[model samples]
Target: MAARALKLKPPPARLWISEWPRGAINAARLAGARRRLREVPRGDGRPVLVLPGLFNSDRSNFALRGYLNRLGYRAFPWVLGRNLGARTIGVEGERLFARIAAVAAETGAPVTLIGVSLGGIMARLAAHRRPDLVREVITVSSPFAGDPRATNVWRAFEWLTGERIDDPRVAALREEIARPLPVPATAIWSASDGLVNGRACRIGGERAIEVVSSHVGVQLNPDVLVVIAKVLNGQNADHD
Candidate 1:
């Protein structure tokens, strides 16, 4: 049977310029509301590994990792440096699987993966291939369920990864990542996202959480943080 491909359009250009300002506002809100985060449920000390978005490095996720750490989870950085699509992680994401395996081995348990933007897509890929090493996956603003061209950053992705959106390998990888994960998965998306289409971020038959955040700053949004904390604390099953 032929593979299923969903073709969704990217977010509007008018929303693109609002990304930075909205992100800044969300960052400020997070800073002021740090105390409220302490009120959220604590984690069970599970290992959680975070992956950065395209053109981003561990630094981009520093705030998120710190928040998870404060909540009692052992949050670790991807440590593979900046994300440049297949160039940094490989076409089959072997490095990402190795990283997940290493964390699982060190912690003596499966690690939950939290990925932002492009990193979320990579997280899903790793979970699909190495479910034994992953406890669960949480994606923020990742467009793993539709046409790669459905993102505003597709051109940038092509330039950085040196792979065309129409490449057969890309198509195959998309199919694999979009498949139902062996382990539990959750998608945190925003219809107001300024990069990828929000519909593409959500997959069928998985828990989906909607937030009013921009694609550029969804990772740092305090609401997103709370939702993630709840999911990790096993308190977000209502969304299922």
Candidate 2:
């Protein structure tokens, strides 16, 4: 049977935590409530372009970018627009591709892409298009096996994104992603991600990792950080 959502019916005592330390049980509600939510392949430290999940803008990724910056890597978010949808698989993709170029031109280094949710798919497509500029792809919750029908939220994706699941444009764009990007890639997902089925996040042709986190909590998850840190450094797996 497929995985089911791990619901948190009882409210947590706390609403927010700046961070979640590693090695702890993947707790959903704390004495205090909080949102909780990682890396490239290990030590390469190339410039990284981060793409936020659906409905998220650069503000959502500022913390992640800051963390990456502190680690001594240059990171950029999509300043061009909020992550609208993959339906723009054609026009918006062109815009996003241009943004990637702009970042590359400014940084003068190959970019390692870190994309979350819908942003994850966009990152993969961008990498596929410009392999030379894209060092590798690191995605969290981006679905590659098309998508799953279990979620009630993806209807929103279909709404905002101009492309329908069967739309010719959407299908055409997916064709490009059929072949995996030439560079190394890692897909991260959680047991509790209700937004997109965790299975959709799988990236073939290399090692993939599964972490324990909610659909919305991955951004604040510390275990996710440890794993993501490994990927950014170019390591496929980590005991850390």
Candidate 3:
């Protein structure tokens, strides 16, 4: 990585505080855009698993799952409870892989994964370990690439997961997950994100869609929903 990239920093403190109000506004935007959101092309009934961000529960992704279901895709939440990092999934993410495999087995087809924030990182790991069971991956506001510290939540992540971000083991896992995924992947990021640096969310070699939104709002943003719908339908979001 270049020296400049290595020096990447988290979003400013002001932006961090703005996330709350911005998230509320984005939610309102989503509500107002519902009619148009429903206009996105439908899917082919492929199963999609939606994973929530750190400290968030499946209930947080309820809106997203409902939207996907309305579009003809079978979307389910990561039912193992609120995301507690390694505590929720296994240290090696064995439990997450098991969930993905179960979904694939139930659907009789490789499953598509849509993960938000830390959930996205876990999704990529699962895809890396078992691409055979994963059809594709879509990440929203997830800092899978670049320094994980380039996010305001790094401290919270460390506190909750009970692991140092600078630990060599964590660094190794980040490098592994940051690599290009074996399955098709798309990254949805926001330059206005308050929780994580947008640059870190999108890797150079993968498909990326940019939206203007707060980090907490990306998963619920109507624009994000549209891009995700396009990707799942196999339509080009190259214009983004």
Candidate 4:
């Protein structure tokens, strides 16, 4: 990578080179929703926990959360206020776990986490720490693999957070995802995602659905909502 790239400044117009011919193939699959998407049964018993991206932006997930509710699932938000980078994830786990516990008590069931971007990353940690409470995890546009440099905005994100992009924990996270989760996991990404390298969105040998959505728009995009519904429904059926 160039020193200029490391500075986290704009490259003006760096047309990112696509590495594979899969983008076209992915688009075609998403275009035929009937052919590509299966009829998913409504959930059986678990409630869903929705995590918004870096900015609290829980409101962004309103559409998907509401959809989950309509499908007979109880859905809740992080409720830690806005996602202000106020606390490192390691620090937030206790609170996140508490929220999970509280939600589980309220609904009388285990929970599924649907996370967007950084929230997705948090969901991974939650699932790793508390499998008893988390039945499944589904993320949209979250980069689970090693490096964030693949995404042009990563440097800027680090700068904004005042943290090192290559923090030792970063490497550990990559290694961790290589291990299988106790429960099922699904990742959703898009070729047009201007922020994340869509390829990095894959997690735990699970299905990675390709959706057409802006990096900032996944929470509200109808296509993303549909995929979330399918995964949540599928997970519920597994127990039945």
lDDT of each: 0.88, 0.64, 0.88, 0.66
The TM-score of candidate 3 is 0.95
lDDT of each residue in 8-51, candidate 4, tens digit only = 22112232333223334434444465432335566665788998
> For candidate 3, lDDT tens digit of each residue in 1-240?
311234478999888899999999889998899788987787889999999999999999999999999999999888989899889999899999999889989989999999999999999989989999999999999998878788988889999889788888887788888888889999998888989999988777789988888988678888888889999988876535
lDDT of 3: 0.88
**How well is each residue in 30-126 modelled by candidate 2, as lDDT tens digits?**
2122222222322444678888877778887776677677666787777856777753335647777877888888888878888887787788888
Residues 1-240 of candidate 1: C-alpha lDDT, one tens digit per residue: 333657788889998889999989988899888787787888889999999998899999999999999889999999999999888897689888888889999999999999999999999999988888899999999998889788888999989878887888888888888888889999999889998899999877899998889887777888888889998988853332
Pairs of residues at least 3 apart in sequence or in different chains that clash in candidate 3:
none
User: All candidates' TM-scores?
Assistant: 0.96, 0.77, 0.95, 0.75
Evaluation by TM-score, superior candidate among 1 and 4: 1
Model 4 whole-model lDDT (C-alpha atoms):
0.66
**Candidate 4 — which pairs collide?**
56-83
Model 4 lDDT, residue 209, Cα:
80
Supply the TM-score for candidate 4: 0.75
lDDT value, residue 151 of candidate 2: 42
TM-score of 2: 0.77
Give candidate 3 misplaced runs (Cα > 4 Å): 1-6, 238-240
